[model samples]
Target: MAIVDEELPTTIFDFLPCFFQVIGIMVLVSWLNPWAFIPSGIATMCMLYIRYRFAHCSRDLKRLEGITRSPFYSYLTSTIHGLKVIRSCHAENICASEFFSHVDTNTRVEYLFLTTTRWAVIRFDWVTVFFVAIVTLLSIGLRVFGRQFSSADIALTLSYSLSLMGLLQWTIRQSVEIETKMTSVERILEYCSLGQETSVQRLPKYEPSINWPSHGRIVFDNVSISYFQDSPLVLRGISLNIEPG
Candidate 1:
């Protein structure tokens, strides 16, 4: 899903273009007033720093949202399939409560994720404000020092400097989003790499006879089971016996 929905189109249509715009505009702004690079460079560094911090938080939030969302959908699906049985058992209220509980939990996580995004955007806006202010001051200082920048050059520099705010924010956001979405691909690859159970094979020369187990008894001892190797055991240390009746 991430591969199709995000990685290809977002990278092509969004991140790359914004990234190039940032670079090209910065270069052109510097050509107007070489001193302009200082504030732009500072703002770029600050944006990267903010992005690093925000990415870690947003990545975890996205993962949590995914985790919380699955149970909601899973429960909703199971409830749909079991509606008749639930009604017959007079468990509608209980089922509804459970469903709403899942909804509440999912909503909470989603809200937290959104609020964090808003917080990052506000901080990005602040950084952009400071960047523009410094650029304006630099322009004034250059003029006072008889560096004589044309009105057109000053306007272009200021305009591009203002535009950089949104472009930088979008680039950082998209890049982090791409990284977070890649986690889905990571999970898929991990699932693909898991060990599979081998199929039983019977050869003509080494086949077991139908009545080989004449005792009609089976036994198990100290068995442990888990769905995945890295996951905790669901069943541990069980012993059982089945004897011929």
Candidate 2:
């Protein structure tokens, strides 16, 4: 579960640079007094949307951990129980169909999620390219208009803007991913903190061993067992003895 949670952030981090580059190009266009900021801002919103979608996916994935596990375990137990009937009836094909159906449902859901995410990333990339072209054209126009901006200044702005955009985009993506992952982490911690069941066969060292004298007698002078501090005793002493034949 931790591994699954970690993967989302890692994936987002890996693709963050492209998003930043797009924003940087927009900033450059803005510097040249062009409307490049418009598309860039739109692209930023798109990126935010993508992050929201992924955050939702991460949460769904975590939820699936429980939902799928339950059905899968149920299927396993049912399969095992019906194995004899399956073999006797030669129902291999039927079993295979059932198994694959479950697998296909899971696969379809995952594929849909991936496809949507991929489309968002690709769209952002295109937006970035569009903004870069706008900035370039605007820069040329500014030169023609006698604004006299240096090539080095343009280059530096583009570089720094791209870097900053990229860093910020990645930071936002990572934050969403972390928030999603924390849900899974909390569940895991809750599970881990649960108290273990006591073993029936184990007894404390101070407990008396089962031994008998020649007369075969037993005693319970003051025995009691209580489940909670405030609860009445479930069992109480009523001494008895028995003799061997």
Candidate 3:
């Protein structure tokens, strides 16, 4: 999770440049005509709304994807390690079916994440189109009634207006992508913040001295065991007494 969050191309370091470019373009548009702020401001609000709606959904999906991915990797690794035993036991079909099930589950989650992403991009593009249309119309009005601005100035503004669509979409996409990707870091931190294991309290009477056992014997009383604190117990209430041969 840490590797995917920090070392991946989707990190904030890669998103910052696009964010700055969006700001630069907005500034340039407003400089072209102060009235452009009316449309730009409206577009900004719409973009913010879109970002707000998508962020929650995207973050959840990303976290789910991260979780669903783990079992697949774990199963794959274990299967590879146990290939010899599995083959000798003639359990290849069962193992193969289980592997595919994990793959299918992981793939379904990934597809949903990608689909939600596309949905956000499409909405963002629509917002950008609206902004560009407003800018173009405002530019035409300024040229027709208010300004003695050069043809070149109008052309440049229109050109920037057209390019703004891509910049705006890219900026929003990166902003949300980076935010969603940070869920990986959040998951890692979650594991870090888990409660520590409780210390065992051994009674002095029951505690054995060093080299105390003369007979080779072992006893377990209502012993429950699990691989991890949160995992289900593999051995529950096991009582066993063994004597050496």
Candidate 4:
């Protein structure tokens, strides 16, 4: 899933193929003169709108997550770097207030975006259910009044419509989630690219006596040390010997 988001084009691109497929299905169902076409189209449109909103919401969430993770460290480091000016100017409270304000903004944005998306999804789902009920009633009435459509035909149409609606909704929802998580994929890739610690090569172990010396002697014929990368050596050559006591 993560790889799909990372490798797949943006949310718009990711949704295009599915969107086209659903449109094709809707057209086919309409041509078939199914009793469920009207309700199914309505449901499909609602689901698509919800899906678009969800994609945007997901993007926001990914950004929020990124900010909350590494961005926090950057913020803190910057704040610390400016501590001297803040202290000197007696603006510690100002700095604190600014930091808190940014944090509050992030919190509000995240909470509101998630809440709105959830509520919208629930509302649209209810609307779809209502449409489904209406379609079922209409199918029943047509079957009774006209006697042109069979009970089985009506049932099949309704079932097919409902199933198509469900499939499209699920597909769009899954795609939105994947698009949103794409940001995390990018982050993970970036993290992986960071330098990794060199691993020690495995070697055969050598067993030693339990009564081995606790300390070892050091003998150096000459040693030198340097402090700076571009500077001359600090310590000159010297000989030293020391025995562990």
Which candidate should be chosen as best, given lDDT against the real structure? 1
Model 1, CA-based lDDT: 0.85
| Candidate structures ordered by lDDT, highest first | 1, 3, 4, 2
Name model 4 segments beyond 4 Å from true.
Answer: 1-35, 71-113, 185-245
Total backbone collisions for each predicted model: 0, 1, 0, 0
lDDT of each: 0.85, 0.63, 0.83, 0.69
Candidate 2 weakest ten by summed lDDT:
212-221
Per-candidate TM-score against the hidden true structure:
0.78, 0.52, 0.81, 0.50
In model 2, what lDDT does residue 98 have? 81
Q: Candidate 4 at residue 148, lDDT?
A: 62
Q: Tens digit of lDDT per residue, candidate 3, span 90-189?
A: 9999999999999999899899989998888889888888888887788888888987566787788778777766777777777788787777778878
Clashing pairs in 4: none
lDDT per residue (tens digit) for residues 34-133 in model 1: 8889988899899899888999988888778878988999999999999899999999999999999999999998999899889888999999999999
lDDT of 4 by residue, 144-227 (tens): 897767777676667656766655765676576667667777777778899986764435463545876556977777887676
Ranking by TM-score: 3, 1, 2, 4
lDDT, model 3, position 178: 77
